[model samples]
Target: MTEVRGVVATGKGKPVEVTTIHVPDPGPGEAVVRVQACGVCHTDLHYREGGISDEYPFLLGHEVAGVVDAVGEGVQDVAAGDFVVLNWRAVCGSCRACRRGRPQYCFDTRNATQPMTLPDGTPLSPALGIGGFAEKTLVHAGQCTKVDPAARPAVVGLLGCGVMAGIGAAVNTGGAGPGDSVAVIGCGGVGNGSIAGAHLAGVRKIIAVDTDPAKLDWARRFGATHTVNATDHDTVQAVRELTDGNGADLVIDAVGVPQTYTQAFYARDLAGTVVLVGVPSPDMRLELPLLDVFARGGALKSSWYGDCLPERDFPMLTELHHQGRLPLEEFVTEEIPLDDVEGAFEKMQAGAVLRSVVAF
Candidate 1:
């Protein structure tokens, strides 16, 4: 086993701490990653708040870019020295989803069999199956999605989660295309990512909605053609006016609240697609008019991880970033040390940053 320092959350609704943890050597089909950069996502905060589960001493941080340090028996796809972006879902090929050629919805995903624990041997539940807030972490070999080494670690690593989900929501789920008008209800990393995706897909109009003016400003950098201040105006009405009173062709709810979801539902054109990429709270309930649901003549889908295949999408998007097609680096509002995670979370709550990446 290898001893490393990791950011761990010890209790529900408690602050996280950087403490010494023991990461075991790779077992069969597993690999050890020497983390270079990891993004502080909302999901990490969710885990700390016990929104994901009651699992304590949770190892937070998952959107990571790292170098493979070791591999165990039967690992062949990646080896030592490979720079990779970690993904939560590493499909088991024999699973029902994979057998049907839809590995994005894999019923069985894999992680390391060995546990990463505290120095006292207390087990730590790694967030999203990736304890990447540490100097080094063990994960399933397939979780390592290789990207171009030339790309910035913090930049591409954001694609490990939120950014990927947003982009995939627009490009993969919504299938936004040329001349299409798209409305993204949120201006966070995921919302801005959807704007970028729509732009890359040749979308002519991208409407960005948010209560924060700073986020609205940031949305423009990602190619949002219009901005909607939700606090000042009716989001649905503004979207309709911007799209010739017909509403947007595609509407993505990146903020998973009932209010925003309702806005997205009504802000789309007839036969338009509505993609929900945000993670909603368990207690939150939806009470849309069943008649409206039946009257909306389009598909309404929830995007799980943007329906993205890491192997296929990661490299392609990173390449686009390299070619100056995707402005992914803009997502990194600040680069911080692992110790500043709590501060980063504060910044996240205040809507002061798009993403605060921990650079080891």
Candidate 2:
């Protein structure tokens, strides 16, 4: 067993603890990663607040950039010293989705067979099956996707979740393309990422809607051609006005609330798509007119991890960042140590920063 320090959520609605844990040696089909940096995602905060489930002590943190330290007997795709980005999706090829040639909608994903534990041998539930907020983590070999070694760990790691999910909501799920007019509601990390993705795809007009003026200004920095302060304007009306009195070709509800979802639904042109990428609480419900749902004449979809295939996206997006096409650096607001995760979560709640990455 290899000893490492990691963050843990000991109970529901409790503060996270940074404690020592034992990570077992890589078993068959597993790899040990020396975590370089992990992003302080809202999901980690959710796990701490008991929003995810009752699994405790839950090992928190998931968005990770690391280097391979060891690999098990069956691992060949990645090896020691290889820099990689950790992902939760380790597609099982035999799943029905894979057999149908749509591995992106993979039904069966992988995790380590052996468990990392507390010093006394109590098993711990690694957050999102990754538990990247540590010096080292054990994962299935397929979870590691080798990306360009030149990319900065702090910035690139965000792509492992929020950023990729936003981009995928636009490009993949929404089918946003050149000549498309796109409107994104909620200009947070994910929403800004959608704006950037729309710009990268050559969308002619990109409209950003948010209640906070600061977030709207930040959205403009990424690629929003038009900004609508939702506090002072009707979101749907603003979006339609920005799209020349009709509506956008693609509307993304990155906020995931009922009001924002309704705005996204009505803010689209005829046959335009609406992509819901924001996470909603289990109790949340959407009450829409059944006739409107049928008359909308377009797709209403949800993007999971932005429908991303890490093996294909990480390397390509890294290259885009290197070429100065994608403004990835804009996402890193600060870099904090592992212990500052609690403080980071506070800031995340306040919307004071886009991301506060933990650098190991």
Candidate 3:
């Protein structure tokens, strides 16, 4: 076992601390990653707030770009020194989803059998099965996807989660195309990512909706052809007006609240798709009319991790970023040290930054 410093949230609504932890050598199908960069995501905040679970002393941080430090027996796909992006869902090939050729929806994902723990031997529940806030972490070999080593870690690491989810929501789930008018609600990191995805897919009219002016400005950088200020206009009306009173071909709700979701439901063209990519609270409930659901004549989909197959999508997106087709680096607002996680969280909550990446 090797000692490393990592961010830990010990209790509900508590600030995370950088403390000592122990990482064991990789076992079968496991690998150790020396994390180079990890992006701070809202999910990490959810874990700290006990919104995810009551698992205390949680090891936080997931969206990771790292180098393989070691691999255990039977690991063949990746070896030591490979630069990789870590994904939470490591598809188990034998699972029903994989057997059906839809591995992105793998029901049984893989993680390391051995646990990283505190110096006193208390096992830490790594957030999203990654716990990449440490200098090094152990994970299933399948969780690490080899990407171009030339890509910046801080920029590429964001692809491990929110960015990938947003892009996947638009390109994969929504099937946005060159002729489609795509409207994305929220304009946060994930929202902007959807806009970027639409842009990458050659969408002609990409609309961004948000209450925050700063966020809307950020959305333009990712390629929003139109911006809707939710505070200033009725979201559905605005989107419809922009799309010739027919609504958009696709509407994505990156803000998972009922109001935004309702807007998304109403802001699409007949037979258009509505994709919900936001993470909503458990207590929040929706009461949409069943009649409206039937009348819409379109699909209402919830995107889980953007419906992405990491092995296939990661390399392709990384290549796009390398080719300057996808502006992946624009998502990073700041680079911080491991000790500034709390400050990073504060910045995120205030909507002051798209991403604050911890560079080790």
Candidate 4:
């Protein structure tokens, strides 16, 4: 076992603390990662606030990149010293989705069988099966996707989650192509990533909608051709106006709220796709007119992890970043030590950053 200092959320609505945790040696099909960087994501905050489950003493922070430090017996795909990005979906090849050749929707993903625990032997629940807030973390070998070693850890690590979600939402789930018109609601990191992905896919018109002016400005930097402040105007109307009095070919709701989703539903052209990438609370409900659903004549899809296959997508995205085509560096708003996680969460809650990465 390895003794590592990690941030732990002891209970709901309480601040996390730096404590010593024991990361056991990798078991069969598992590997140990010496984390180089991990991004502060909203999911971590959700876990800390008990939005995920009742599991306490949660080890949070999932978006990560690192070097493989060790591998257990039967692990052949990756070895020690290999640079990798951690992924939550460690697909089980025999699952129904995998059998159908859609491993991205693998119903039975792999995770570490051995638990990382506190010094007192209390078991720690890893966030998204990857608690990377520590110096090191243990995960299934399948969860480690090899990437270009030259890429900056802080920037590339963002691909492990939100950034990937946004990009894949456009290119993978939405099937955006050349000359398509796209509109993204919620101009946060994920939304801007969708805009960037659309641009890369050769979309002709990209409209960004958000209540925050700062985020809208950031969206423009990410490839938004037009910006609409949702707080100042009707989002659906604005999107329609930007697309020549017709709605966009694709409308993405990155905010996940009922209102934003409704806006996205109404902001798409006939037969256009509506992709919901934002996560919603359990209490939130949607009540659209039943007749309208049939009348829309389009797909209403929900993107999980942007429908990405990490093994296929991660390397390509890293190459794009390296080629200066993806602008992955722009998503990183700040970098801080692991100790600053609490403060980073504060900034995230206040909408002050796109991403605050933790550098080890």
Candidate 5:
């Protein structure tokens, strides 16, 4: 075991604190990672607020990039020196989803068999099974996906979560490609990722929708051909006008609220795809007309982690960023120390930055 300083949320709505914790040496099928950088994702805040579970003293932070520090028995794919991105969905190859050859939807995922704990021996529940806001963390060996060592840890670490989700929502789930007209509702990290993905796929018309002009500008940097200020105009109408009155071929709702989702539903062309990459609150409900669901003549799909296979996607994305084809580095609005996570959360809530990454 080793001692490390990490951000921990001890109770619901409590501010996270940088405190001492114990990271066990990798057990069988596990690996210990020396974290280089980790992004401040909204999901981490959700965990801190007890929105995810009642697991208090939660080890917060998930989106991570690191180097393998140690590997346990029988691990061969990664070694002590490999640069990697830690992913939550460590697929179990024998699960039902994997048996059917769709490991992205693997029915069973794995985490380190042993626990990370506090000084008093209380176990910490890792946010999404990757407690990365620390100097080092232990995870399932499969969680470590080797990527280009040349890539910046602060930039590529985001692919561990939101960025990947946004990109996958468009490319993998939405099947965006050349000649497609895509509209993304929301201009945050995930939304900009969708815009970037659509750009990568060579979509002809990319429309960005948001209330914040600054975020819309960020969307343009990612790759939006047009912008719609939703606060001033109706979202569906603006998207339709931009797409030649036919609506976008693919509409992504990156904001998980009912209003944005409804806008996405009505803003797609006939037979167009609508992908929901945003996570909605558990208590929130949608009340769309049942007839509309049947008559839309398209698919309404919810994306979990952008339906990504981390092992396959992470390396590919890192290489793309390294090639300068994808401006992944632009996503990092600021770099912060691990101790400023509370301030980072405040900045996130105030819409002050796209991402505040913790660089170890």
Candidate 6:
């Protein structure tokens, strides 16, 4: 086992601490990653609050960019020196979803069999099976997706989660295309990414909706043709007004609340698509009229990890970033040290940052 310094959330609502932890050497189908940078996502905060589960002593951090340090006996896809983006979905090929050729929805995902432990030998549950807020982390070989080494770790790491989810929501799930009109609710990193993805897919009009004007300004940078202040205007009505009395060709809900979802449902044109990419809590529920569901005459889809095939999506996105076609770097609002995760989380909750990356 390799000893490393890592951040740990010991209990619900308690402050996270920097502590020494043990990372075991790769076993079969596993690999050790020497982390370069990791992004502080809302999901990490959720995990800390026990919103995810009762897993205590949680090793937190998921969106990560790292270099392989060791490979297990059976690992063959990646080598020790390769820079990679860590993904949560380590698809099991034998699962029903994979057998049906939709590995993006792979029901059986793999994680490291080995446990990372605290200094006293208490086993730590790695968040999202990544636990990237450490000098090194162990994961299934399938969790690491090789990206361009030249790409900035802080920027590329965001692609591992939120950014990927947003981009894939538009391009892959929503099937956004040239001349299509698109509207995205919520102007955070994910929503802005959806706007960027829609632009990349050649969408003619992109409307960004948010209560915060600052985020709307940020949305414009990502190619939003129009902005809606949700606090002052009705989102669905504004979207319709922008799209010439017909709703947008596609409407994506990046805010996972029932209200935003309802707006998305009403903001799409007849036969248009509605993609929900934001995550919701178990207690949250949506009740839509069955008659309206049938009258909408369109598809209501949920995008998990942006419906992405990591092998295909990660490399292509990295190339786009390298070519200056994608604004991956713009999503990184700040870079903090590993010890500043708590402060970064505050900034994230206050909407002061799109992404605060932890650099090891």
Q: Model 4, range 259-357, lDDT digits (tens) per residue? A: 999999999998899999999988999999999989979999999999999999999999998998999999999999999999999999899999999
lDDT at 70, model 1: 97
- Global Cα RMSD, each model: 0.7, 0.8, 0.6, 0.7, 0.8, 0.8
Alpha-carbon error at 18 in model 2, in Å?
0.7
- Give candidate 1's TM-score: 0.99
List lDDT for all candidates, in order: 0.94, 0.91, 0.96, 0.95, 0.94, 0.94
lDDT of 1 at 85: 99
The true-versus-predicted C-alpha distance at residue 149 of model 3, in Å, is 0.6
| Residues 131-213 of candidate 1: C-alpha lDDT, one tens digit per residue | 88999999999999999988889899999999999999999999999989999999899999999999999999999999999
The weakest ten consecutive residues by lDDT in model 5 span 48-57
Give the C-alpha miss distance for residue 95 in model 1, angstroms: 1.6
Residue pairs clashing in model 5 are: none
The regions of model 1 sitting more than 4 angstroms off are none
lDDT of 5 at 217: 94
The TM-score values for the models, in the order shown, are: 0.99, 0.99, 0.99, 0.99, 0.99, 0.99
Compared to the true structure, candidate 5 yields what TM-score? 0.99
Q: What's model 1's lDDT at 143?
A: 97
